[model samples]
Target chain A: MSAEETVSQPNPIEQFELHRIFPLEINGIETSFTNASLFMLLAALGVVALMVLATSRQAIVPGRIQSLAEMLYEFVANMVRQTAGKEGMKFFPFVFSLFSFILIANLIGLVPYTYSVTSQIVVTFAFAALVLTLVVVYGVYRNGLGFLKLFVPHGVPLPVLVVLVPIEIISFLSRPISLSVRLFANILAGHITLAVFGGFVVLLLASNGWSFLAPVPLLAIVALYALELLVACLQAFVFSVLTCVYLNDAIHPGH
Target chain B: MKMTIISPAFAAESEQETHETVGATGGEAHHEGGFPPFQQENFAPQIVWLIGIFGILYLLMSRVALPRVGGILENRETKIASDLEASREMQAKAQAAARANEENIRLRREEAQAIGRDAQQKIANEAAAQRTRAETEAAEKIRAAEARISAAKTQALGNVEQIAIDAAASIIEKLSGAGVDKDRLVAEYRNVKSS
Candidate 1:
């Protein structure tokens, strides 16, 4: 390896994980509270507090906070009702909480020194698994063994069953994996890009000449940050809507 | 099918390159690992956390949020229905009041027409009575004038007869005086008559 190349390259992943806030080890199992985890927990609590405070009064003519709260409430509520029907309303609070939590986590990450919990696959996977579990348990509870029929498309030839069933099951199982990876990858890539651009600015300025070229990357980073904000909102919405759709399938399994 | 073969080869090469990059950095630090730290390796805690949050959320939605919204909508429906009933009642009352007013106006007009007819009859009777009284007074005055004229005509005829008789007697008396010697005159008259 060339000396200049070695000097220029930095470990991006290490830099991303440097701010580990808590360290704990117990028995053979060690669980540490990461800065990312801390921020996510705080964001979740903040969302809850804001929702509660905004809705506690229940004014006929809503104030700004109350209006915001109601808009979000109705947004998720309508999504559930439209996708899942009357039975889906029962899932409104869960879907709403999930949406709010993920939304806040994504937005809070944009702040300096705040870690984005959603960038981690473990976090996203957990969210996806919970949704999947709900779909399964609820589907079986509602439809009994008939819930397995979800894997079998109707009106297909019997001879196709052998090929189709396994493919359907694999596709079903892949849902959580894809759902988690989509969110994690998007957030992780955005943050890494921002960091690299920032590092470029630093390196250019430190080199003392040709520093003016740094503005181009800086401008790009700014634009990317704005785009990330939009993505964050979109991803949160997509996640919540998909959850609603999955629950809808569980409630009414045909089509 | 042929393209698929090339795609997998390209993907494998990309994966290998990524691993090599990771390995090259932090050489001894990377080598010292049996597994990455539990923080890095274990996905269990996150799964547990997400499941727990979702479970709590589901319970809250089923128990709390939905019921409140349903109640609000139901209450609004009841309120609107009651308000409509009240307005209908007010409308009915107003219609009844208007009907009563119309009936009163009709009765009043009939009463006024009856009173006008009675007044007109009384005025016509008074005029007829006045005309009859005037005719009676005129006839009485004519009768009294005729009686006075007949009495005056009778009196004038009696006066005219007395005057004529007096004048005739006086002429006869004058002629007799002129001839004082009546007996002598009578002898003479007898003579003359014989002649």
Candidate 2:
């Protein structure tokens, strides 16, 4: 038991561990650069390179890269058009960046030992907060206090509104939390599961005779990794879609 | 219970020994139960970099990537629409030209027909005038010939009358062997002529 206790653990959760790369301080602020920063920078750079290089030629006939870039452009463009009307296209840059950043971050995380920026709750919250902030600013600026009409459900009894109105407000207020948590949780869980299964392979291989059983977890890891990739892409899409839906409320407040 | 059954018995001890020796360097540092993300030390850097990277990304997306892409698409769309409009205009122009050509041909044909009819009418009038002139000449010639014939007949008839009188007188004189009375012969001739 003592010998067993001395043995080091497989530690799947440690993959999420943040490490300081360049310790930094600005005006008595602790702003040390870290692994999360590195991956985020990579993700952003990757996105920029893709967008810039893809559209550099601006060919009348699109190549693969240009097609991809244009596809992303139209995807968000259509989303905004559908959800928030043409007026909402003004916010397309922010929404597109949000989607691209999250997607790239998630995909980068799927690499063997990279940090997932979107997996960070604070990071996801930051995106969600920006979306909410834009919604509030646009809603109030455009509609004034009439923006409060979002909470009032139509075709319902006035008496029921007494009870239902608060619920509506609560749900409205919960948007950022739900949106942020959904993305964060998906990435967090997927990554953790992947790490654990990866750890399982290591554990099985380390033990005598248990090495034969390692292929099962390895296969599972392969499948889960595939699933994580899907989840990563889907989560990014969901985040952007939700952003559009929320912006829709800002644009047309009554409904 | 599962560990003891390994067939690679010789390698297991060496593996464990190395693992034990290097375990501190690789494993113990990461496995602490406290959540790695919530560690207060990591937040500030992540935020600062997040802001920096995300700002750059936003700039790239908004100012560079999006506008270029949008311009390309917009340019293509406008080009296509203008090309379509131009082609449509050209088709309409072609049709109009064809219609004008048809009209020109019809007008020319009608003018030609009118010219032909005018020429035919003018020829007919000239022919009628010519025919009338020819007929008048023929009629004048026939009148002159008829007058000449009537004169000739008058002269010849006078000569015949004189010859007849002379023959008759000579016959009477020769038969009777006397001179005939001129007044009596004239009176007989006049009676015969009158009869």
Candidate 3:
């Protein structure tokens, strides 16, 4: 019984372990290179390779890869235009990069034995922080003190302003936390669940007379993987869409 | 333990303090650390790399890749617009050419009809003139033939009187057995004819 327990210990969380690839101290900061950095680089490079190399021909009639690139471009472009309006196009590059990176990171993580960069709260928080920072900075720079009107919605009764304004502010303050946590938790939970099911298959096969039950967890993992793939894509889309919504507030606040 | 591991939310909360302590001790202790994600030591590196790589990606997208795509799309739009304009112009020109051709056909048909009418009128006039000339010549020839017959008839009548007198004198000579004077006979015949 002890041996079996030791052998089938639910080691699902072990996949998230980060091993430092290159140890570096930057101005006494422990900014060592790790698996997360490698995957982030891969995701960035993947975006660049797709965007840059595919359009090299610049065909009047697009090839398949070029079509894919254009489709992604137009998808995000239309999303930004619809959500944030026409003037919101200035943030197209930022939105595109955020969307593409998160999407690719999620997909790469779905691969067995690959580290999911977006699974880290620090990485997702960095993205959320970046988006929020841009919103506040650009909002103030463009709209000045009127940016605060985002909290003070229009056409509300004076008595309700007391309740509504604080709620809006609290929600506004919670945006980064929610944004970062939503993505991190989704990816982390998906990977953990997959690992858990996968662990079941191993645990079942290791036991006497229970090996026949191994295929059940294996089948469940296959199904869950498909769902996780959908979740991965959905989470990326949600993140970018929310980013656009917040930027819309910056662009056209108060209403 | 199994339930906690399966439920990541619980695991994250329950394991945070242990992971932080393990992070502080560092090195070999990380393998046995609780919930590697919540470990504090990993934040700086991931943040730095996220910033650095994300910055690079932003630059690549904004400065290089995006413009090329926009250019391709804009070029396609302009090409379609220009193509449509050219086709429209061609159609208008073709319509104009067709109209001109129809007009030419109408004019030529009218000219041909006019020529045909003039030829018919000219032919009728020439036929009438030829018939008039032929009738006149025929009538003149018939009148001349009639005049010649009348002259011949007058000459024959003059000879008929002399011959008849000669015959009457010859018969009287045979019957009376006497010679007759031709001059007296002719005078007698003349007086009889006048009577």
Candidate 4:
């Protein structure tokens, strides 16, 4: 057992490990530039290249790239309008950035040997925290303490209020946790599952009798990879949609 | 088979030590060996980059890209609306022209009917006047001819009687070698004719 442990271990989790590319110190914090930062930069560049570079022509009739860029803009714009109302359009930029960033990051991460930035809990949590912070700030600023009516139902008995208010507050407080973890966990789980299945294929190939059965896990990886691709885009959409919903709550808090 | 089954947890520890020692040399020297994601040393950099890059993206999107896209969409909408309006105006103009053309045709048709009726009335009046004139002229000619015939018949009758009387007188003279009185013979012939 001890001798076998020293040999090649099928370590799927090792894919997520970060190594510093450039050690960065800002004031005193260790803000070293790592693979995650690289992908994040790539994601931002991807957005700029698509949104800015693709639309330089500004044609009356859109070509393919312009059409694609316009479609994305309208899509997120409509989402914000529908979920958050016309007034919610104020937060359109923030929501659009979040959606595109997560979408690109998730998709790029699916490519082999690239880090999935969204898989990091801190990154996803930061977005969630930002969303929650904006909601509270905007909600209170716009509606004042009347925003607290979000927890207090309009037509409930006082007895029910005692139970319902706590539930509402708890659900409200858990928004960031759920929002962040949902994206992070989905991406993290999908990559880990793919890596594990990939490791199975490698291990099966190395074994003598089981070499022929390696195609099974390889097929499984293929299926899982497809699922992961769907998840990547879906989670991005879900995150933005949830953000819109929360912002809606902030805008009109009586409900 | 056993190696594959037992490796994830065991491999994580071994990977952790290597990463930690590497972390010690690197700036993140306070690293603990466990799950890579759960490790505290990696969080700050990812968060900083996320905030920094995300902020830049937000700025680019809000200031530049979105406005251009919105302008494109708005321009297309206005163009379509104006095109539709122009087409509608053209359609109205065509309809009015057709209405005027129909009105013109109707007026010409009524004028033609009125002119035809006037000609028919004029021809009827001329025909009636001609008929009256010709009839009056023929009647006058017949009356004159009748008057002349009557006069000629009367003269012939008178002459016939005188000739007869003379014939009688001549016969007597030739037979008896005597001259006869014309007035007496005429008177006698008249009395005989009367009787």
Candidate 5:
């Protein structure tokens, strides 16, 4: 439960709480715009604005913004090219957008007092589901029933095949769950750990006897913050690299 | 004795439990018992915004940004290619011009050398002609000078011969009382001059 603070202790989960900026509904659907949604929008805008401003001048000699944008473009482009093959370049836009959105969303969440969109299960799951959907759609579209051949491991004996096939199917089914969880859990855990450590400082300082120990928790929070920053970027990269791998599966779908 | 001590501790524990439960219940009632993201109410807007913004980002990337970057990169490639080609052409032109310049200098040098040789030959010919004309004129002057001196000596000798003949005739008339012919004496002086 988020925002579950009690009288006795500071609940770290409260940081994940959502409050609607404007309570909204339509056709009997409650569509309240949330802090989570706000940050998601900010992250998207930040990515778009970066790309637009970088290429706005289109100078032969790139400036800092252009260099960053170009580097990011080539980074994702090369990732798809290497993992998914040249044909995979068709999905470069999708991969770039996903990578940018997740990376920026993760970074922004690291800022104090800002919401972390990728930390939300719904957001990460939505992204995972999108990747899974594309993989299934393209895999089947390109390879037809041959795509199912991916499950049947080659050179395995008939008796051993029974065990391997189900494992492969289960593993395939688990991709989205793992994809979403990896990002969601990493961010959720990092932020919560940071909050838990930070709460100890308040708890220590508030207690007359433990005032001297407040600095200890405060120092721990500092160390955790740096670690959290690394986790933020690492989780984003992990998510992107997995996306490319899944995409490669879609493209090949044979082995 | 155990009951007396345990009762207070039990009462204190129950009271704390009551307070904690009340707070938990109160908080649960307020936000409800779930993760905010899992709450059914928030999903629609999040999904909606996610779709909308992701759509915009995708369009911006595929339609505008990526193509623009590609165009710029391709433009740079062509620019480099054309620049290299132009430089190569210029180099070729420079090489050709240098060759032509060297050829022209060679031609001019050959022409100047030919003119120098011709002028040397012409001066030699003119000097030889002037030397031959001067030599012929000097020999003619020598021959005329020699003829003139010989004629003058002959005339002086004739005058002296007449004077001798006259002197001899006067002596012969005065001393020998005989005068030989002047013509004969002149003839005898001419023979003696010949011998």
Candidate 6:
């Protein structure tokens, strides 16, 4: 409140952190339900409920909600089929659910009062770990030890295996890290950009002298929000599609 | 094998970029906390949670959502096939009806021709009988007219004979010698007429 305390530049990364509600402590550990987790859970449930309600009363000629439901189904189905072929159908439900969950989470975060779960490393890592687990387990199950052949390069000099194998294993293990980072970074960056633009508009308006110029930042924020909506859906789709591709590699390990 | 090796190499290059970004961000958070900050819940609980979600999702999808969708698709296919079969049956029935109708027309045409032939034969027979009857009746009428002319001719001949005899007697009385010969002349005329 002091006159000497000037307005400082906002830290975009800290702005993205989920603020703890009730600030509860359990055995000296932070056990509070954060806003981000709450919204993420809500988004997941919302997606499930939407799909159920949309498809429950499936008419011979689909109504609008049913058509939308079918569209989402067909979209994910075709993506899987394209990426993994007939083998993909076995993974259809998982991929479709993943796509819907991420899509809904992203869209829900765009709401003013909601937090984006994908912006959090923990949440993204959870999804990435699931994908990586399936890839490893299913790969070995389907192909057995032959799955190890995936690390060995074909038509290469045998001497090069020394250099290639370790690099390949490290790369394989890094799948979850890269997957998680891609989604988390995109969502986090987009939100931060929007927040910064919004802060500019607020600061401009508060200045009063630059009230006329406030519309510029406000317009930029609106445009960026729209862009963010697109990016949100795109990132979800990219994540799901990449998971399918990885599953394809697991099912048929070599080529 | 070649793709597998190449793919991971490509992925690693991208991973390197991500690590660099993470490193940059991690440095900024160093004052608040150390690099690779530990969570309140360790990896074990997080793994359990992940596994739990995966299991539930797997069950929901495999048991519930998949079957519902598959059932809908199967029902649609069955309905379409049944509809198609029903239409095919209708088409076959229509074709059979059309063929029966053509057969009926063919039979009626043959029957009509037979009836027409019978009518013509009946008319020909009646016409032949009428012609024969008329010929016979005309022949009888001609024979009766011939008989009536013959009778009239005979009666006229007898009257002429009597007139001739009377004329001959009168001529004989005009002369004594002729009178004596008139009886003989009339007798000669009667003999000649009889002959």
- Best-matching candidate per lDDT: 3
Residue A20, candidate 4: Cα error in Å is 1.2
Please give, for residues A101-197, the per-residue lDDT of candidate 5 as tens digits: 8989988888878888887777888899999999999999999988887889778899998999999999999999989878877887777667666
lDDT of 6 by residue, B1-195 (tens): 111222222232232122222242432232133212223243233333334454565566557665665565567678889999999999999999999999999999999999999999999999999999998888888789878877777877766765666665666665544544546776787799799
Better of 2 and 5 by TM-score: 2
lDDT of each: 0.67, 0.80, 0.85, 0.84, 0.78, 0.69
Off by over 4 Å in 3: A1-7, B1-5, B8-31, B124-195
Expressed as tens digits, the lDDT of each residue in B51-154 for candidate 4 is 88999999999999998888888998999999999999999999999999999999999999999999999999999889989988988888898889888888
By summed lDDT, the worst window of 10 consecutive residues in model 2 chain A runs over: A1-10
Q: What is the lDDT of residue A122 in candidate 6?
A: 71
The estimated TM-scores of all candidates read 0.66, 0.71, 0.79, 0.82, 0.70, 0.69
Candidate closest to the true structure, highest DockQ? 4
lDDT of 6 at A132: 92
User: What ranges in model 4 sit over 4 Å off?
Assistant: A1-8, B1-32, B120-195
Q: Find the candidate with the highest TM-score and give its number.
A: 4
Error of 1 at A1 (Å): 29
lDDT of 4 by residue, A167-222 (tens): 99999999999898889878877877777677667777888898899999899988
State which candidate, 2 or 3, has the greater DockQ. 3
- The per-prediction i-RMS, to one decimal, reads 6.8, 6.8, 3.3, 4.1, 9.1, 8.1
Quote the RMSD, in angstroms, for model 5: 9.2
TM (B chain), model 2: 0.59
TM-score for predicted model 4 compared with the true structure: 0.82
Tens-place lDDT per residue, model 3, B1-195, is 122334443342243233333322131222354457677788899998889999999999999999998889889999999999999999999999999999999999999999999999999999999999999999899889888888887878777766776787888898887999988988877798899
Local error of candidate 3 at B97, Å?
Answer: 2.6
Better of 2 and 6 by TM-score: 2
Per-prediction DockQ: 0.11, 0.28, 0.38, 0.41, 0.21, 0.08
